[model samples]
Target: MTTRFDPRKALLALSAPVLAILVAVIVTSLILVVAGDPVGEVWSTILSVPRPRVVVSIINASIVYYISAVAVAIGFRMNLFNIGVDGQYRIAAFAAAVVAGEGWLPGPLNILLGLLVAMLAGGIWAGIAGLLKVYRGVSEVISTIMLNAIATILVAFLLRKVAFRTEGSNIISTTPLPEDSRVPGMAIIPDVSREVYGLLFLAVVVGFFYWFILGKTRFGFDLRATGRSETAAVASGVKVKRMVLMSMVLSGVVAGLVGMPLLFGQDHAYGSTFQPGLGFAGIAIALLGRNHPIGIIFAALLWGFLEQQSNALQITAGVSDRLVLIIQGVIVLSVVIAYEVIRRANVRFEQRKVAQALEEQESMTKEGAPA
Candidate 1:
């Protein structure tokens, strides 16, 4: 069955996030004023045009964020919350770093090998939770959380005991990938010394696949069906357990790519200093984006922009960089509240329309029948 496009519905859907953002801005401004900060200066600093370097940084950061959000969104679509994305990506990255550091294969092949290993590591790590949920009836939330802690400990052990350290570096890290295996950054932003990530195209591809897989395919239909109602899905011949496992694994596979941009284009190795907490951040982005691929892109860009501007806020407006955190927290909360309010409003409108239609039908029936 084809669903016709409804512009009003689309507008209504978009309103929640927009309203939430405006509320966040207002709240943040009030907070600044109350804290004796220069609210106007803070606003100006955040809203001003960024330098080319900062733009590049924001774009790069958004790429990573977009990928992470996509990973989280996959599980969200399946009614699964794979919170261990942090661990999945970290383990996968360490595995990739270990492989790339070896340079056993020729240039391009080495890069491909590392990527494959990363996906495998991530899938296997997340699959454990899937297995537990399917066979042992363990809550994925609990299992994944436990897995995250274990993954951290395991990675730490492997880094110290198994992975070779880069020579002369104080930071404990895997051997850096060979020059040939490293992806060179693209000079997409002219006049900016900072180059965009070489793997920017990868994010595009991931987004396209995410949209297609979830919106187009039979598997996608079954996944959504199961998400909506497991009992009904089972009655319709969907394999709920298998879907759960596959969805979790797929999410982890994408999660594995979350670190690749940094690993290949910038960091070139997994290290103690590798960025953490992106998995948690991705959850917020996914929520903000409403699990839609296009919405996720905007949400990620907004998140990255705010993060990039936080430094400027601290330096120029003399506000603490932590102000951004408060703003972000408020935005997330506001989105939740806004969406709930909009949902209730929609329900009421629909109910009223149905009642009016029923009343008109009754009046017309009486006039035609007894008169």
Candidate 2:
């Protein structure tokens, strides 16, 4: 058998993305200087130890972005392009807020049920795309994109017609959810922000579960098999159609969870654009993390840190935050291209190994027969 890939080569391959990230950082820095801002001051602010509350917000933001990113990675692992997590998250939050507004349940239980509602709703929404792809051969990319537009429109219509129609608020949004619906928050570690600490605890749990589900479960294997080759999986008696549908549902559920931390964990009210475009960050986090859940945690933190510093860059380096946006876009695109290239190369290598093994078997058979 052909030797497996060299460990050093794999390490270097993994580091390639880090190198790109470093290069992007430098490029961003240079742009800041060119924009007439002082880089030194910006660097200082980014590295400076801040008071407890600000630190808490940063940690909270990191956890939020990281968890959402993990959700995105789940979909990507199954070969499903979940480009509409933004829509999924927003819609789920909307549903949670509606339930909260109705005051239909008690405190902690209401919060838990609201989260469940969001998770199920978002999963169902994404499942629609999965169904279309499986049954009609429609590309998920197209369907998910269309679903995003539909989600936005639906949210807008609901906000205007019912949820937050209070007097004189021009911006469309759902009304503030009742206090009882808020998820009880707590500090994770002593001396850390309570909210941040609680979120970190949740993050760890999610991370552990992510590993267990993807590594130890038969369902994960089926999903992987389907992603690698649907035809082969079907021949092996694995239900490829069901797996695809399940993948979308699972991914959507995770995306829905993203809404929970926001609605109950962070904000009690749901605004239309309260945190727009955060879901797309998952695409970057997935690529940067290489679709590994643990890696996504770090990648998400890095992106979050950069974003936190972005506003400081404006004041010190005179660079617009959009500069960060450009850099992130390029990074995501590069990761995607590189991932595709490596995947194809791996496939070719496997094919060659199979061919060589077959040839060796035939030669041995011939030699024995002649003897």
Candidate 3:
């Protein structure tokens, strides 16, 4: 039997983002007015985007954000909260940088080794939370949060004790990766001075795999089933503990990529100046995207655009860049509320449709028997 198209459900899904954006825009405009900023001017500056350089920067930034968000999304799909992504990627990058700096192999081999080190470091870090959850009955949420703090301390200690190296101007950083280990940037935009990240393709590949594995694989079915109802999944003979562990590790593997674009394409080393808070940002992005790989890409790009706009806002409107933070926070909150509301409405609509169909069938049966 063929299933009919669900326009109402489709509309409801689309409305979540649209309505949330509308609410955020309205609220942000009011705040801008109170702060003596011209809403129109601010938006104009943001939308103008200035130059090809700025566009390239946004795309590059979005690639990193995409990796981070997808990592968080993997955990989200399995009802696991891997808050330790921050720590996972930091340590992973540091270790990978240290290994890559050795430069003991051919260019391709060196790059592969660096990536392997990153994945191992991140997976091991995330596995700690998974182990605690499966064997010790600890909540992954609590364990992961604690692990984040521990990771910060551990990274600092390692940086000082082992990986410390002074670079130009006495900047503290891990040993810089050799040229052979670095991923070259792509000159995707013709005549643009800025080069797009080579690792952007990696993010796209990860997204494709995420969508395929989750939608078309048996493990994906078990993972989704367990997420929906653990008891039912257990009764169906799905291995809950193993699934949980696998999901967390898979999330960490992706989290390892979060630092690669910046590491290979720009920084070439892990340093004190490395960007932090991306893991937290990933959580917000994942929620905004509803944990779908394709959705996460758009969410990441939107976030990157907002971040890039902050500079324009600062220069053109003479507004504090912090205004972008307020906008982001409002957007995230509104999106969450909007999705929840839409979900409930959709559930009701489905229930009503089923009830009506049942009633119609019952009436038809009764008329045929009596007449």
Candidate 4:
């Protein structure tokens, strides 16, 4: 059947971003005005990361951030919040780093071993929450939060007792992986200090797999159905508990990679100074993207840009770093409101169209009088 054109629906879809941007701009500008800062100038500074080096840095950062966001998105698709992704990845990376440091075989083999270890660690960690939810009726959120704290303490103890190594630079870290196992960066632009991360290819592969699984696979359908309504999905013959377990494991698998881009490509070791809070940032990005792979990429990029712009904001506009936080919060709130309004409008439009079709059919029936 041919579908009717939905002008209101189309307009609402486009207006969401527009409205969000307008709100964010107004709010941020007002904040700047109150602080006696030139609003236009501050905005200009935020947008000044168009330079080649800055752009490369943003891209590099986005690679890791995109993986982190995708990990979060997987859980969101199943209506589960895997909040312990930070703990999962950190512990996984540490364990992977220790394994990679033990040069047992050749370059490729060692790297493969490290990746496998990371995935195993993350999956085991997340599986605990899944198991608890299925068997004990515990909430995943509460269990995952507790698991994060446990993971942090466990890693700290391991680093001190088992995996610790003193580098020449006086930085205590997990033993470094061999150079041969490290992913080499691509110097895409000449005379630039930054090199595009070798793990960018890994991110692309992950994005493709995420799209394929969600858009094409049967498990994807069941996962989505469960998310929509667990009781209905269970009645439909879907094993909801099994789906939950599998989804959490899969989410953890992706979360395992969140640290690899930095671990294999940049740091080559897990240290006390390794970047944290990526999993939390992933939560925000996944929400912003609404759990689509392509959407997550753009969301991650925007988030990375904002993070990268913080330096420029401080240097050029003399603004506090907290301003970025304010803008981000406003944008997220605005988008959520816009989407809700659009959802209600679309529902009303669909109802009206159905009623009109029914009325037209009744009128046609009445005109065919048999008198």
Best by lDDT: 1
lDDT by residue for model 1 (38-115), tens: 989998988888889999999999999999999999999999999999999999999999888989998889988998
Instruction: Kindly indicate the candidate among 1 and 3 with the higher lDDT.
Output: 1
Error of 1 at 94 (Å): 0.3
lDDT of 4 by residue, 310-355 (tens): 7677777788877888888888888888778878888898899999
* Stronger candidate by lDDT (1 vs 2): 1
Let me know the TM-score candidate 2 reaches against the reference structure: 0.82
Candidates in descending lDDT order:
1, 3, 4, 2
Prediction-by-prediction clash tally: 0, 3, 0, 0
| Per-prediction TM-score | 0.95, 0.82, 0.96, 0.93
Which ten contiguous residues of candidate 1 have the minimum total lDDT?
Answer: 161-170
User: Candidate 4: which stretches are off by over 4 Å?
Assistant: 1-11, 163-170
- Report how far off residue 98 is in candidate 3 (Å): 0.8
The models' CA-based lDDT, in order, is 0.93, 0.75, 0.88, 0.85
Sort all candidates by TM-score, best to worst.
Answer: 3, 1, 4, 2
Candidate 2 yields a Cα-based lDDT of 0.75
Candidate 3 wrongly placed segments (more than 4 Å): 1-5, 163-168
Which window of ten consecutive residues has the lowest lDDT sum in model 4?
162-171
